[model samples]
Target: MRGRFARAARLAALLVLAGTVQAAPVHASEVAHPFTVLGTPDRRDVVTWGASADRTGDAVADRSYRLVVHTSVGGGDLRIRLSNAFGDRPVTFDSVYAGLRRDGAELVHGSNRPLTFSGARSVVVPAGGVALSDPLPGRLPAATDLVISIHTPDAAGPATGHWMAMQTSYATQGDHTAQESAGAWTETTGSWTYLDAVSVRPPTGTAAVVALGDSITDGWQSTSDLDRRWPDYLARRLSTAHTRVKGVANEGISGNKVLADGAGQSALNRLRRDVLSQPGVRTVFLFEGVNDIKAHTGVTAQDLIAGYREIAQRVHAAGKCVVASTVAPFKGWSEWDPAGEAVRQEVNTYLRGSGDFDAVTDFDHILRSPYDPERMLPFFDGGDHIHPNDKGMQAMADAVDLSRLDCAGRR
Candidate 1:
């Protein structure tokens, strides 16, 4: 009896250590967190736009930023979330505004509006904290270029942001949050800083699905100025569908892993903040693991499967469904080998057969070439053979059955 107990204890310890990836502001919830509900019992606020936060460089002081992001669903009372997740000190934003973008560094004349934080014009977000803007009462259209301008007069710690936004945004030296002209904004950048999410109050029963992935979903190989990520394409599909999952949140990070924290905290580490913390989330669309499998770190099929099971379990525990996808083929990438290919096949087979997730999307089959079997189709290849081009991204989105994302099954 003593021996058996000791063995079980060791096994438990190993499981805990293997699953852990260090992230600040960790959640200890064994069940779904009862965060502040957005609306009354009849309606709710769903996440219309989201981007994962990673530890980039340091923040610049007295800088005015005009970040542009694309929204998935249309609703009223728009809200935005500013994150200082990796900062070591408090960062204060003295001025912030939201408006409809009109060309380079320009905003619609009457559409630029001020955003308050708890009824104040300014907000100070502490390290590892998020500040949600007070909802602006207005109609926001889906697939619109929503530009948010911010003035950070005092910020000098580690910056928290998404580095590969695949969208062009503007920055300058002064506080021009309410400007409609392109003059004040003089610099251009491809990353999205400080800002992370945008939410909106939708009609009754309108819910959302959050896509949790890596660079493929982050639009690495796709055209830079165009919103052509697989998740972006998926969002477009959800817009015209008659399903409850109208909103889509792209929570993907560039060069992110599932089992370790490299580019950002692993998927398991950031799941709570990036996926479950959002309002009215009904499903989590998970598509990751190539980095883990090809790291040449001896990550086996079982290891990847273990990660998938844990992700699905947590989502289910939160009363949400999981829509997992098989990892796409990367046979031509430099890291590919016989061992990695074997592991990929094993993982994909399990993803298709395992009954652990609520649903499965066969991304491997969709992206793989019929002739090569182990390679991506030439037309879809992004030169690296690991990522898919814009056309391939759209194909993956079109393959998804929009009805499967309906939240009715979860309810």
Candidate 2:
């Protein structure tokens, strides 16, 4: 009986130990969180940082910007991308927070959480450098917008930005603990800090939309933080339609040409990096070649068409649906050459007739003046005769037939 009691006691101790082991929580530290780079090559390569320092004592007010990331699939951590790409001096942050914004003002309920990068909550971005956050704690939902708020104490250097893409907005904190409002962004001062890129998971069963073009597709004249660019408008439209398609990857490099190398690299040179190598890419909207006409003084229409054909073949071979877009009217552009205009017309004719594309987007029809067939629609032109304003961008996005896309189809 004594031996049996001892054995039973040992068994009870073993059961208790097992319960303790089972109850041990799995630390977030123990799990490996991975992230993939999104957008086109330019989106991955270019980093824009905002700076504001007036003459005099440099008493700059606190500045902040919101960052929004769309996860591909659910159940993964996130990291924020911050830039000091153009800063002359190190930029320091007082604090930062991550949460969801409601009604464009407040952080929604159950959405506030602290974030860290390299184990430090706050960091200094060196001149011409970037910093990324450590893995965030929460499980980001696929296609959900995760907002990152950053607050800085002093004025950064005068900043340069890609004005076309919309930016996330952020609120400020009063102290180091950064215990300020987590709900809404009412108290925040607007910032122009350049946000180069963001990292996220690939969406499950969904692919990316690659916007391949020039300055127009790059969002040259659009308002900051407004999301009024064609790609931004398209993303909102896609999300609202409940289409599982991921966000548009803006591979549009400013001043990029189809046949020649400029503004990072030519379409042919960067095709693999920009389109083929893009995360979750399945569709490409090619809106380039106008630069080639304008820049290449002696290039003929046939040359441009050949370039388009080559680009289409390469994109298709990479297992992507290529949608060719006609170049918009450039009659009034500062560099308007009658010879270039002639070439443009010839190229447009080929683009319309060329069966090389899996699909085509008629940007000329959307932006061209009804009264003046050669000129861009006056209202859409942002006085540059080249880059379109926010309104023009909206018109372009609206012209796309989303129904034509088999969003579920694999490339």
Winning model by TM-score: 1
Could you give candidate 1's per-residue lDDT for residues 1-411 as a string of tens digits?
222222222221100001112221334531231122211211367899999988879889999899999889877777788888788888899999888887878876667778777667787877776777776766677888889999999789798889899999998987888787999898999989999989888787888999999999888999987899988899888888878788999999988888888888889888987888787788899999999988998898998999899998888877888988999999889999989999999999999999998889998999999999799998899889999999999999998878777646664
lDDT of 2 by residue, 110-165 (tens): 46566555555566666544555554434455445555666667745644233333
Whole-model Cα lDDT of every candidate shown, in order: 0.82, 0.58
**Model 1, C-alpha of 110: deviation from truth (Å):** 0.5
Q: State model 2's lDDT.
A: 0.58
Clashes of each: 0, 17
Off by over 4 Å in 2: 1-196, 199-203, 407-410
* TM-score of each predicted structure versus truth: 0.90, 0.63
